[model samples]
Target: MSQPPKTQHASIPEPLAHPETRGIELIQATQRHGRARDLFPVWAAPNVSVLNFTVGASLILLGLELWQAFVVIIIGSLPWILTGIVATSGPAAGTSGSVITRAIYGIRGNRVVVAFFGWFISAVFLALNWLASSFMGAELLGQFGFTDPVLAPVLVTIVVAAVTVLVAVFGHGLILRSYPAVASVLLAIFLLVTAFVLPHAQWGYVAPEPLEGAPLWSAMTIGFAILASTPLSYTNSPDLARYLPESTKPSRIIAATALGGALPCIFFTAAGALMATGIDAVAMDLGIESALLALLPAWLGPIFVVGVIINTIALNGMTTYTASMAFQSIGVPIRRIPSAVVVGAIGTALTIYLVMSTSLLDAVNLMLQLLVLISGPTMAVFATDVILRRNRYSGAELFDEDPGSPFWYNGGWHVPGLLAVVLGAASASLFLTNPAWTGPIAAAMGLVDLSVPVSLLVTAGIYIALTRLAAKRRPGVLPAVENAAA
Candidate 1:
């Protein structure tokens, strides 16, 4: 049973109701009572579609065995390489991560930091991918004696972003339609090329010694880092989930969805591992290029490079789509930029900048580190709240904006939120080796002096105690507050 609410404030406005602005209704549900009915669907096609785009391209990056990539792949990625899959039994949205922050730090448990920072990270990723794809595309043509790389990358990025934006704006059906055609052909090419190049690979370097100090752990971390986007992958799941007719088992949906996305990691890592040993890693930075040079005669390399370009485009489209969602999550409030236009334009700009900047490698590392650091405590709290607190997410109250809700911390920002976040940030800054924001996150974690798993434990414990104390005190003070309100 729910308690009668305190009087609603006259100042606050309801969420804007615009037909044009849509939610990630990727799940099938209707607005009934207080709770939204539709659980996010774990669909197969969208999952696979995203997988083909994301994992397929990721394998291509595996070709660039930069830093510890090779060591990570060889040691901990045994299962992934064998199957090329990254399954998802965990929470989808960075929701877990988001919850941790809300429960502990930020606006009395109203932590929108996940959405805020995640959008930035995803935006940067989109930019990087667009930059890489466009730059690489231009280079492919330039290598053969085309023209200027600068103009080509920039122009091409704009064009590609434009196309991607169109799809995102129109509908999901259009995006799904292209997946089979593009992913199937690319998968075939990737396989056929791998089949041919297998013989050419230098068998001697297949398994280099494990990373210098902690090979297994480092390897697993690297492998896991590659799938860093896994939790955030729920952005689109909402779209696909919306269609499952509400009766579908979300857990089953998640399993199947993860399976589709994960399958490519096996072959992709394998392809990367095999090539890392066989060819100069940099020279084979482009998988198809390596496969072409290794297996096919020299002349055919260009043709397949074109296919790689297509594959890149398909995935870039997904990147563009996700980027738009991230932007819309923020941009809608500030102004009224169309999600499509925002995604495409910003994507193009960021991509070109990152691709040209050479510092992008640093950028990527920083992004991943932040995601992990933030995700740790976040997932913990969310999981606990879902399983322990409400049984199954009975309700969520954005208490920061609307203090009348049941969960409201009732003031500006809660003390626990500020303290927990500071601690987490400090710990992350100290422990994590990556630069930029990573150091701060490690520092954040260090401030708390808890391992991610343990820090999560500590964070949850602290918050639970804090919330209970608040609840116990609330009833005693209500009469006075009510009298004051009257």
Candidate 2:
């Protein structure tokens, strides 16, 4: 492999004072800083939102008992381990996940994947989280008697979008420095929420007409898929971890990232499910925020609203940051700050449209469901590549777009990797069961959705087999197994 360029040391700036100037470029070893443990809050803060509560509530609405929902939540969280594994590539490669994927999918081929799965999906999530926060913000306003239905939502959305955009424009340094505090605040508020809601929970609550046989399994699988969507969407885990020093242990990174995300998601989502047991399912479905606010004392209502908005900013900021990076990685002409602004503007517009026209719960459910067909396979491919390559990545070579670059296989496309993603997504579609459409396999199997597992297995299997075969036939295509260690 060609040697990386000589290290160019850049002094770290005061994160609050200056915006981060780096885009999709590789971080030099000298410029790398931070510890794996720091990643905990970075991952945690985003998942600590009212949105996750809705996810739990949705599981209940899907006809599963409380225990079944808990089980599904835990199982869904397993993908965060894959997220952690993908994150290790960050420090080892010293570049954002979007950039590092150049090796797995080849330079040009990766651009398409990053543009669609990375950027587009991120933008949608940005909109979804923003919409969730705007609803809470408007409700908070209502608590103070500012309940102009139309005006309140517009004002709140604008402010929320602006704050989220500013954070994204500030970029990685600020995110690293601030997320710990954000996570702490959100956790504290939610803990209070839990304390209040726990007492009202119907622990042994059972569905009036409990589903049995194929129907029960179907509900469980669908619930698992819904909960899994959040973790699976985070292929950008490496985007935040790229600044960590190369010497950081992979195990630390894996544990920190996985636990940080899984713990809060499980807790908050379970809280949502618990809250639902006391709430009428119809009310919870119509407006989770309203239903939740009705349960809390008046004083806590505003506080909870504020917490939801803060959580939204944290979540949306992370999404915008990743989307900005994905845009740059797609060979966009604009720089990072402009890219962030563009993403924010798009998300804001989307939030307004959804608020004015669509049902929030329906949008959230459909978006999460549709995303799995792509996200599951995508994350699986990324994790599999990390293992097959043994975490060995050349940051500098990834930047080289020339045909001579080591990653420039078959005219800037690794046929096996691209083909694997296509076949995996296609296979996944066959087993997908969502409101919009039910897959053939799902229909045959009594409405059970197996897309999540099917996509992961097919994508990983194909990539591993094809990668090994290509490596055997072409010696330089992959690193020697003994020499390939991060």
Candidate 3:
């Protein structure tokens, strides 16, 4: 691997001490600080949400037995490992994942994916999380006898959006410093929730009329896809890891990122599954809040609401922070703070519409199921690029935009990389099964959704083969152009 260029340490403000004013710029070696372990809370605090509980419960509703649901949760959570591997690029490249894509898809070509996958998808997630938080916030208010339905939702939306956007606008420093405490508080509340909910679980619960053969397999695949979508959607892991020093070991980064996220995700999701066994599947169909609140004592209700809202802010804070970088990466001539405010404004609007016009439970299920088709291929291409270059990148060269720049191949587009993504997403669509639409192949195959694996394999295979062939024609292309900084 090529070494990052040596430069005198820049006198940047300590990220933990002040607002991170930087955008997508390269971080000098001296500017880099923080250990790999610090990333644990950064990733963990965000996953401690009721969304995981809903996903876990959906497995039982889909006809899986309790043991089967546990197996699915473990398998589905494996995508965090892929997410961790992608994070190694941040320290190696000394820049956010949004900028690193210039190396894979070229400057202009990258804008398309970055805009769609990075900005648009992230904005949608911001709205979804904000909506979740607003629901919980309103429920908390209702307990206080503030039950004016119209007035309650509006008030909750404002409070949730304000807290989330402010943290994001403050940027990286505050996030890192605050997440450990956030994670601890959320974890404690969830453990208390677990204590009250688990005893009511039917440990050996089975579906009243168990699905058989192809139907069973199809249900399992869909369930796995739903559970995996949360981790797979996070192609921005590198955004958080970008400030870590280059000397940070790859194994440490990968372990901390993967374990931190996967452990809580599995635990809470399984807790949801356990909770599902005790409730009427019909009652859960209403929403996680009603189902869960019915089981908890009145005193724990307010505490549970607090945990949900805190987790939402943590989740949306990370999304908005990364989405701002993505907006800049799209060639927008905007700074970080303004971009975050714009994202927040848009998310708040969407949250209000979702609250008034649609069922939150239905929207969540459909969005997650469809998201995997695009997110799986996008993440696969990024992980494949990181491996091909041996995690070597030039933070400065990635910023280069001239025609002579190494990344400006074939008129600012890496044809092979772009082709791989297009083909991979198209192929995955043929096997996708969701409420919006079922893919032809999936319909033919008794509704089995194989979109996740199909997308990853197809995207990775094409990129590797094409990248190697291109390297044969151009000697210095394979190992990342020797990192001009080196």
> What lDDT would each prediction earn against the true structure?
0.43, 0.85, 0.85
C-alpha lDDT of residue 264 in model 1:
54
Cα deviation of 36 in candidate 2 (Å)?
Answer: 0.6
Residue 207, candidate 2: Cα error in Å is 0.6
- Please write out the lDDT profile of model 1 over residues 1-486, one tens digit for every residue: 221221212212113232223433222123211111112111222222212222322333433333344444333222221111111111222112223233333333343554555455556656655654565467566766777847777776777677666655544344444565665666666666566656765655423343343433433453444444334333333333322322333455444444444455444545545544554545544533233344555555555555655655555555555445543333244221366576567667777776566432344434544554554444444433433332222113221234554334455355554455446444534545443433444344332212344435555565555545554577632232223223
- Ranking the candidates on TM-score from highest down gives 2, 3, 1
lDDT of 1: 0.43
In candidate 2, what are the lDDT values of residues 236-321, reduced to their tens digit? Answer: 88898988777788999999999999999988899888888988867775588788888889889888888989998998998898
Clashes of each: 47, 0, 0
Per-residue lDDT, model 2, residue 440, is 96
Tell me the TM-score of each prediction against the true structure. Answer: 0.65, 0.95, 0.95
Q: Model 2: what TM-score?
A: 0.95
Report the CA-based lDDT of candidate 3 relative to the real structure. 0.85
Question: Candidate 3 has what TM-score?
Answer: 0.95
Model 2 misplaced stretches (Cα beyond 4 Å): 2-14, 480-486
